[model samples]
Target: MGGLAWLTPRKRSATARSVLAGEAAAEAARKTEHEHESEFPTPGDTRAAAFFDLDNTVMQGAALFHFGRGLYKRRFFRTRDLTRFAWQQACFRIAGSENPEHMEDVRSSALSIVKGHRVAELMRIGEEIYDEYMADRIWPGTRALAQAHLDAGQKVWLVTAAPVETATIIARRLGLTGALGTVAESVDGVYTGRLVGEPLHGPAKAEAVRALAAAEDLDLDRCAAYSDSANDIPMLSLVGYPYAINPDNRLRVHARENGWRLRDYRTGRKAARVGIPAAAGVGAVAGGTVALVALQRRRR
Candidate 1:
């Protein structure tokens, strides 16, 4: 009955109803934040935790894009969906942040891809995908930083807009505390293709950190955050120690202005020779992906 409440509501578009439903799911996560504690004991500094962004900060490229590729290989989605993911990945790799328009398309397509899929099935595949696509892409410098936090007896979490299941798998693989990511709505262990709240991006990322902090009895002044995009400034600002890792242009400038510490692993001759052209190539492919997505939808 609760899930069907939207059916009895006053005038609301399908998009609006989806948003409202997601918000309700997010509220539930907030209320239960405390219960989602790290299974590993924090014996050293229990009040502090380090939060790392998934893309470009911890991993080399878009985590979702990698996941999508893995899913595509398994025939979980059609070729058009994969193309859309490639466009998003390219934009992210080049600009170092999400394009709002692409993100909306991605959100819709991502939901469509998972509709009617079992949660357990996705989780099982996600584990394999991580080993195949993500394991080698982790930035060693970022891994060490997270390790330092763990050594200090503090929790370390990955907070990203990627699906929570995927994020959790990465955290577990890395031997970190846990992750906070966008939730996909599920019923009877099957995905309903709707999100739980918004994707955990931008201001929403900060909000999630705050909720987790409150729930885990963490001190914001003792916590830290790392990211590669200016879009994450809100989350970065919330921590006592903020770092810009492999930052894009806007983030680099903003970090300098704010006196946030910056680290760039993609330096030296190799990056100079190959990086710019690679980024440009990625940005150029978005148009084709968008067209393909539209065509696929029409065919359906």
Candidate 2:
């Protein structure tokens, strides 16, 4: 019996070696095919550009919410406090009050909850959640818009404040060129809950877009930018064509004041109606909800 056991390991080792050789050969073939495909660009390429926001613009809700929920389920956060934290976020979204105190509270709480956790574990959890929930949560209209840009031979970039790793995964899934997002700092494979650079939010989003534009040689005046919040004003203004999709109260006001075109694809209809003025410079009030227009400048 001992002799048989020793022989079994040698047999298994031989089988493993054979399998690895086959895998390596297959991988090399796949790489060759991929390289060939990348060598050729499709004909009739008109170099236009488009920028999309992550939350509410491309997705139905904030990615952070789901990530937080996943962390809570993993016992990283107190189960009882999770609900309260979610409620606060909801309030912040609705009010657009920009309460630094509340923002810090949420940030610190989330950090405290996730402290000492390995980055790999969080990433694994995020991946599982993304496949099951995050991917499906994409807004239909947003997807269509992104596809249109790709079809038009335009470059599409996703500008977000989410972690770069998470954003990059989504971009790859969508077949986008790349993404610009906040990068979380890591030390020894563990998260520090601190950003490596500036958070890609508000004006910072615009900065990232500018950097991409310069790197890709994109014409900002000919590029299109889309967002749902007034906080995105810096980014939206940077592009020649600015679009406000399902905007919040502040953004609705800014859109109308700026004469930007409005679109609501949530109902699957191309927005065709100009919003009536609610307050000067603000969008028309509709059903107690604000509807702002998007702006696009014709290519001259």
Candidate 3:
């Protein structure tokens, strides 16, 4: 134990440094981009907002995957890219955790696919895709929760690792205040195939909320956050009210231990299944790949 004593502190220091860096990056993003605030102003509470996770929390599947499916339908990415997305989806579904390396792979692939596309073009398509594929997938319970916050006059925001464009579209459609998502670098309204910072996942998510709270003059103690995976524990811990909605096993345990509220919208059989098959097989060709790969191996 003594031999490893020096390494423990060094690791902790490194982690602390990484988290601080993430916060700084998110702060910069907030300043550069204008979040889409609600048009209908609320007068009840101006100092508090609710931050919600996108995938498996506000929707049934990964928002990014759904966006990828739309891109695939529009021939934005080739079959090769679809295969990688499927593998990543399978991995994410099975693990039920935000593995940094896995998310990095997805980020890199998404950037490459949108390298030369115009931001406006993608946003237009995203709207269409959301209507066709994502609109009905939203959980009625979760929708009601968000509506309740809106009815209370508190702003509601979506904080997700999905692309900012996609998240913003969803927020607007749902009549939320705004969304904070992974920003992709663009030049002249065209994507440059790069990110402004890290994906808004895990610790970075907490950093984003902190930065936004400071900017908006929001009271952190009055804020609330909701998510499904334990990966968002950092973000969940930032707010006064943290809810585990459709929580994974680890999050379920953590929420119970912390005396947090837990809500599960899925049945026992559905909960046992990762539900990656649909996301993995987003396209006809990818569907066949999922069939052969047997990603449902996790259900066993």
Candidate 4:
């Protein structure tokens, strides 16, 4: 009986030692895994960046237009206001209007509509609107451009004047590295209808790109910038490769004067829009149709 009692203490000590050893091994393995993860860089960690503007640069029209339409449908904005907004935007498009007073009025009016809405509510609405309108509205050529950058192992970012929540949703869905956009401020969960930072447009867009480049250690000299508007001239000038995708008249003139490459993705050819051969257009249409069908099937 005494021997059995003496052996019991040794057995318990051995069991305790085994458990302690197992725990130590597990902790060591966890630490090793964490270190490995830290060693590998994510898509956003690249030293090269491809900055893309959201409106006519990536899609055919302004993202704000679609967002406003969605808001109108949801009763968050009045139909009459939406109509007026659309008309004003159309005029801006046609005339290349950069009147400060007109721009400020539009911005103020848009912000006033969501003055008291909760951030969570607005975010919910954004998600719903994204699924309904924004997702399918991605321009045919924009996704291909983004994918090409990804393939080249470059970090692709969406820079826009659209609200951050809305832009982030689209960026994430497209597997972009990151996004920078205007931020609407909230106080105690409700919106105050003011921006947290400068509105990401014109020179503001260039500033955001600079800040992002510095933070991510991206080399501006090796980066690319794409936009369709003359307002993006500052942003385009900041990068090594400035591409005008479906450029407006002003931007097209600037691009031509600077000998920058002009691409018309809408026509799906490497040639200028004015001189595109009929055969090339036919080939582009056929190829685009096949690619789109393949994309739809892949999504399904």
Every model's TM-score:
0.78, 0.69, 0.80, 0.73
lDDT of 3 by residue, 45-154 (tens): 77877788988888987887778888898898799888888787787767665567877788888889889999999999999999988999887667777776776667
Pairs in clash, predicted candidate 3 = none
Q: What overall lDDT, based on C-alpha atoms, would model 2 receive against the true structure?
A: 0.61
Candidate 3, which segments miss by more than 4 Å at Cα?
A: 1-38, 94-97, 271-300
List, residue by residue over 39-123, the lDDT tens digit for candidate 1.
Answer: 5555676788889998888899888889889989999889878988998888877766667677777777878888999989999
lDDT, candidates in the order shown: 0.75, 0.61, 0.75, 0.65
User: Residue-wise lDDT of candidate 4 within 66-107, one digit each (tens)?
Assistant: 777888988887777988778757865555323345555666
Clashes of each: 1, 7, 0, 0
> In candidate 4, what residue range of length 10 has the lowest lDDT sum?
21-30
In model 1, the clashing pairs are 22-197
lDDT of 4 at 53: 83
Model 4 sits at a Cα RMSD from the real structure of 19.3
Q: Write the per-residue lDDT of candidate 2 for residues 3-94, one digit (tens) a residue.
A: 33655786755444333332332232233324543532322233467788887777766666666777777777676678867876686556
Candidate 4 C-alpha error for residue 15, in Å: 70
Better of 2 and 3 by lDDT: 3
